[model samples]
Target: MTTTLKISPIIGNSQARRAAAASFFGSMLEFYEFFIYATAASLVFGHIMFPEESDVGALLSLATFGVAYIARPLGALIFGHIGDTIGRRATLIISLIMMGTATVLIGFLPTYHQIGIAAPIVLVVLRILQGISAAGESAGSASLTIEQAPEGRRGLFGSSVTSGVAVGFVLASLVFLPIMALPEEDLLAWGWRIPFWLSSIILIVAYFIRRRIEEPEVFAESRRTGHTSKMPIVAVVRDWWRDLLRVTGACLFLAVQALMTVFALGYVPATTTITSSDMLWVWIIANAVSAVLMPVAGMLSDRYGRKPIFITGCISLAVSVFVFFNAVGTGSLLLVGLAGVLTMGVCYSFANGVYPAFFPEMFNVRVRYSGYAISLQLGLIVTGFTPTAAQSLVGVGVGPAWFLPATLGAALALVAAATAWTAKETAHLPLHELGTDRNLRLGKRRIS
Candidate 1:
């Protein structure tokens, strides 16, 4: 007698493609909402939000920039639990709504001059909301994409979310570049609000698309098997603490990226003669290159493995920081743009492309959201302070313009690289085996 084995429903070629496209577009919109604030915080908020602090406005502005990251891990824990317990689709939809609402509110906020201290207070509150929502977005989208991807192509497919982030930065810069280019008198008054207001349209679109996406197959399977954790945080901390530590360490690479992109923009504007328009141009050029390069890096990680690509990216960033800072300090627009393009476009893409696959691959589906979210956000929280810390290190013009921060960035990247080296290689492992102790042992055996 012949017996037929029942097969689970597979996400087909058409569906996978559709899902990836939706994920990519939705992530792009979501990040656009998130990053436009970063851009504005660096360029415009010093004047509008904290106009009183003549000596420390830039530091305060960047501090507010870091404030959002303070809320991120909490957001991650809350949203990650909901995502792992309920569904990735539901979590993502709610995050998009929260981020969009906060961004739109930022556009409408009164200036410090108009409302005194109340303006910055309200801005910080809204920024915290945006941070909370962003903490779950990449993790949720990555979880959805990886679960839907076909075997042997998870690395390639999973990277669409990161690709979306690069696209979002590009879109944010493109939107802000034009506004910054407007006459100086107009820029501070109404032009700065345009990018924040435009976030609404993308938010609405992301909400609709996310609402339509089906729950990931793996998540559904976990629920069916009664394998879902009652408390993902406890499970992750107990069973996957090592992986969480490693991922948290690996995330220092992201600190360098954010520091260069967001903090550096504000830093250069204050210390050097570079105009805000010129700085915006640098962001536009670099992110435009990154938009193309990130996917290529993602594809390459599929072929070469995640570690080599990530390591190369980190080393490149370490070296590039010196040149990037020196170029900015010299006030050469061309060199500044080149530095931005090379660091963000080339070096950062290597890390960005691989992380979506790398971070999720470190955890089991049951605790994947919690492990990835908590660790990554915790690491980011450290880097979020980097802008302020780096500024403090360069105090009162006694230190060299780029030396202190560049050294700090380099040191952080090296530590992350070392942690990554200690991490188990998951490129060849099956999705079901990921995040289990057995896989780590298996990886060690194979290496031996």
Candidate 2:
């Protein structure tokens, strides 16, 4: 007797919800590891990992933070292939392991005083590895979650992953609050390492949860039907280049993020009386608001449209960043916190919430992972150095030239909004029908 093994034609809602939860916690844990490095770059690395000249050290530390972006594209190409060809689950697991291991090693690294010139070199190398890991993280998580989502709900599920990113920022800030309170000597010597070390615990738990997640039926069905691409990167570039460019331009909005978190943290404390602890509080509050609202933004995209919400976010962010910097100059923590909330929390959330679904929806499942990952990382490469560039423009120890970076951010935001306007609206398209020709949708030709 011959036996046939049957695959489920449709994924259950329960499995879909489970995939969404896994994406949420996976992003939360992975980014917790990533952003802690950002916090340390702003507050601790200059003192411990570089020469004692405060200005030069601060610039170098922020430069090291930027180094990761250079490697991110490389990671995106490598892992995007794996995700498209092998499966999203395996790609996610591999990236998490790389990220977690690098973060923990950073905690144990020797200071410049102990290791001389080798310290900063090693620091930059590790930062690059972290960047590589991050390259795969959101792309894989979002791809998995959206593939599992039922029709008309992809935005809502994808937002859960983005909202987890906001939660990661909150967790990173909360963990560092006590560390930021330590005396300068203690903070530089040891307190900062604690946050990096904490990532190990989160990594282990995340690994186990992610390991059990089944591959999304959409991807699995693609493979069974012989629709999987052998060279996804080449296919994506050739077929989806227009969408690729649009995603890259839309991703320029991340410059707003670089300025909001890394640059603002360093700027507020140095140019004003706001303590590092106060800035930490600002991070906590703003990201908390963002975490709550991101899902709402996603759901709104599911109903109204992706372009409207994202374009509005770009415009609002352009305006609110200026308000945030001015509030910092006023030396009022309350105003600064409010501005931070408006900029990072409310305005940014609108674009961020829907991007996971929006970007991937621009391509067919055969190349969706590669298409989104490559374009997203290419855009990040420019924004990643934003803090270093802002520092150069403002000059260390000069009275707040906050306006320069803020102006740069506004220009980038407006450009991203314009780019977002050019993309086709994909929220209402069926998952199987995404990335098909517009003529097919218009019934000019039959859809395959």
Candidate 3:
């Protein structure tokens, strides 16, 4: 007797929720590892990893942050192909493993004092590996959660992943707050390493959870129907390049997040009177509020469409960033803190919250992973260098105060907003209808 294989139903509400939970926790752990490096780079690296001259140390430390971005695109291309051709679940597992290992090794590295010139060189190498891992995390998580989501709720689930990132940032800040309070000697010698070591634990748990999570039904069906792309990257480069450019441009809004955490935090202590703790508190508070509101933004996008919410986010970010810097220039702790909350928490939330839905929806399933991963990571290269560039620019004074970080943030924000405004609204399109002109929804079934 011949037997037919039974296909699974299109992801039901239960599986969609499970995927969102997986995406959330996976993102939380991955970003927890990432932000520790970012936090330490801003607060501790200059002292331990580089030469003792404070200015030189600060510049080199921030430059190391940029180094990771340089590696992200390579990761994106590799994993994007794997996700599109093999499966999102496998791609996600490997990426997490790489990130976790690099982060833990960073915890054990010898300081420059112990290792001479080779310390920073090792540090740079590890940072590049972390970048490669990160390149896949956001895109894979977003695509998985998106494919699993039922119609009309992709934005809501997408926001869960962003909220995971926000929570990770908050957790990273809380872990470091006490460490930063340690005496300079103790902090350099031991306390800072503690946060990185925590990654080993989070990584193991995340890997297991992600490995067990099944590939989304939609992608599985696509493969069964022979609709999977043989060379997704080639297809992306050839057919979807315009959407790729738009996605990359839209992803530039991420620069604001980096500016908020890195440049703005560094700038306050390096030039202004605000304490690092005070700034950390501002970050903690603002990011907390932003996390709470991210789902609201996503649901709104689901209802009103992605472009409107995203464009509004970009414009609000533009105005808020200008105000944030201007407030910093005034030297009042309250004004500075409030400005941070307004820009990072409120204005930028719109930009960050909407992309998980807006970005992935732009491509067909075969190229969706490649399109989202490559475009977003390529845009983030600019964000990675933002701290170094902002610092360098301020050294020469630019047009009152707004001409520095604000000008850069505003210009990027405006460009991203224009990109979103011109793009087609995808929220109303059915999952099967999305990213298709001639391409039809490959595999679909009636859920019984």
233 Cα displacement, candidate 2 (Å) = 1.0
Tell me the deviation in Å of residue 314 in model 3.
Answer: 0.6
TM-score of 2: 0.94
Tens digits of lDDT, candidate 1, 65-90? 88988999999999989988887888
Each candidate's lDDT (Cα)? 0.80, 0.87, 0.86
TM-score of 1: 0.92
Regions of model 1 farther than 4 Å from truth: 1-10, 51-54, 271-273, 395-399, 438-448
Error of 2 at 417 (Å): 0.8
Residue 273 lDDT in model 1?
81
After the best TM-score superposition of candidate 1, give how far the Cα of residue 324 lies from its true spot, in angstroms: 1.5
Itemize residue pairs with steric clashes in candidate 1: none
Candidate 2 at residue 438, lDDT? 40
* lDDT (Cα, 0-100) at 168 in candidate 1: 84
Runs of candidate 2 exceeding 4 Å displacement:
1-11, 53-55, 395-400, 438-448
